[model samples]
Target: MSDEDGAGAGEQLSDDQKQEIAVWFLSNAPAGEIHYVAKDVRALLRDEAVYEAAAAEAYPEYNKAHLVSLELPDRSGDIIITTYGELDKNNYLDPRTAQVATVDHVKQTCTKLRPAADEELPSAYIEEFRNAIDMELSKYVGEAYPKGVCAVYCTSGKDIEEPGADFGLAVVISAARRSPQNFCNGSWRSVWTLEFSYAFQLVEIKGKIQVDAHYFEEGNVQLDTDIDRKDSTLLQTPEDTAVSVTNIIRHQETEYFSSLEESYLNLSDATFKDLRRKLPVTRTLFPWHNTVAFTLTRDLANELGIGK
Candidate 1:
């Protein structure tokens, strides 16, 4: 429900009141509430029951959020990936927070189904998903992370603990608050969960160690099959090392240069802005690029009397 739903708490809804509320909702939303009329209404009568069933009441009461049941696919057989909103139709901002965002309020039950059994399935596959939860996960509240609540969500990996319907889910919520918009623009920003800018292993099962990751952002997740390390002898000689460390070094260099260029630009811009405040400017060259040894462009060299 929205923060401004205006449902005053008169010390919890009673059995009669709950029934009346359901009747009211059903009467008001007959077209949409038709499916849930058979199920869920009894459970949702009391707020506590609703929270206990949905696992979404973890936020502070001020947020005024409600529990939402998201039905992800069982992945029975065919190659089709089952997608559902972690909470598609929230009463708040863009409740459908995913790549695919559409809702038909006509029914609450699943609209479609697929088969995943007959086709040979891998032992497991990496599923990339995301969301933002809270910092502290308490027993009284629902499942949140160890930081403040994050607005973004990414569910990157599912380990598939069992073969049947009893699969385990490793959910990651992007709980970082007060961040630059770039941080959530599908780019990596350091987060406490990712261990603060340490080297990481993206280990996808595409069959080789082809890695391309920029900044390991807060909510990014990996299936960690450790597929690359699985067949390694750990102490093999260079002759047997199909994976060379040089390739890794090259990747790091590429990422480093990109960041260096960004930093240089920022420094340059800041330096010039500050200098204009203090003295006359013959050029707009910011001095920030001077903090580290400047790497001048060929054209800039001749202008600055370097390589003259």
Candidate 2:
């Protein structure tokens, strides 16, 4: 790649393709994720330089310092949201509720790596690193994976390590499917390969906790039949769907979050019994974590007259 401002270094790539390349580079580059990140940052700064030059020529009032440079906080983290699934207009499930199952996850955390000195700007560095990535993407402007990046700028970090306090400087990812025709090509065909970026934050925790439960329209018999039939129509169900779901909850309760059982002890016998009566399927409630997840059978839901 030529070093002439690094604006036009390589062949223009689609936004998705660029992200794929970036992921591969971060995971497998010879120097590793950190090294590749630094290199990308330098390249992005070069692109910024090129932009400034062009803008300066066109508008005499253009200021280089005022350019859209990255402003990062001392303790900052990066979040990446990846979502899949076509917009099924026929389905009536709440998008937000369904999205709870497929929310994006934080692929990396840079908080611990930040410089300890008070004068250092670790967040700024991280933001610059992220900006460099955005700069590397092609200059496309349409919805089909159009190139763009956004960051939350902060000035401070969480210093106290209080118990039960979530990471002060952290990144979280959330994702949801959109309409099938959300990103149609010139031929009006939905482009499944396309992706987009979104970000948000939650400020407070109320008295209530959100729960996630997947309701199967088909009863256990139908679920088993579908699994056995291996019908392509049941795209969401695998042959081991029942087994996998059961094992997942079992594993989380028995091995991963064993402390949850202690938290369960605090609930009154009536509440506990009522919970089991309502959700008799493979389920687990982690009171300490404020999470209750369930995998329900259609028959049980019907018995409760849930969707009648």
* Leading candidate by lDDT: 1
Using TM-score as the measure, which candidate wins? 1
Relative to the true structure, how large is the alpha-carbon lDDT of every model? 0.26, 0.24
Cα lDDT tens digits for candidate 2, 90-191: 111111112111111121221222222332222443333223322222111122222222222112232322222221111111111122132200100111
Q: After superposing candidate 2, which stretches have Cα over 4 Å from the reference?
A: 1-126, 129-168, 177-211, 214-308
Query: What are the RMSD figures for all models against the true structure?
Result: 20.6, 25.6
lDDT of 1 by residue, 1-308 (tens): 44377555545555555555655444322111223442465455546554333222222111121111223233221111112123333222211222232222222223443232311121322121111111121110122222212222122223433322221112122211222242211111111111101122221211121111212246532111111211111212222211322233223323543554454457445644565433356645435545332332221222212112
Looking at candidate 1, what is the lDDT of residue 191? 16
Q: Model 1: what TM-score?
A: 0.19
* Reference-based TM-score of each model: 0.19, 0.16
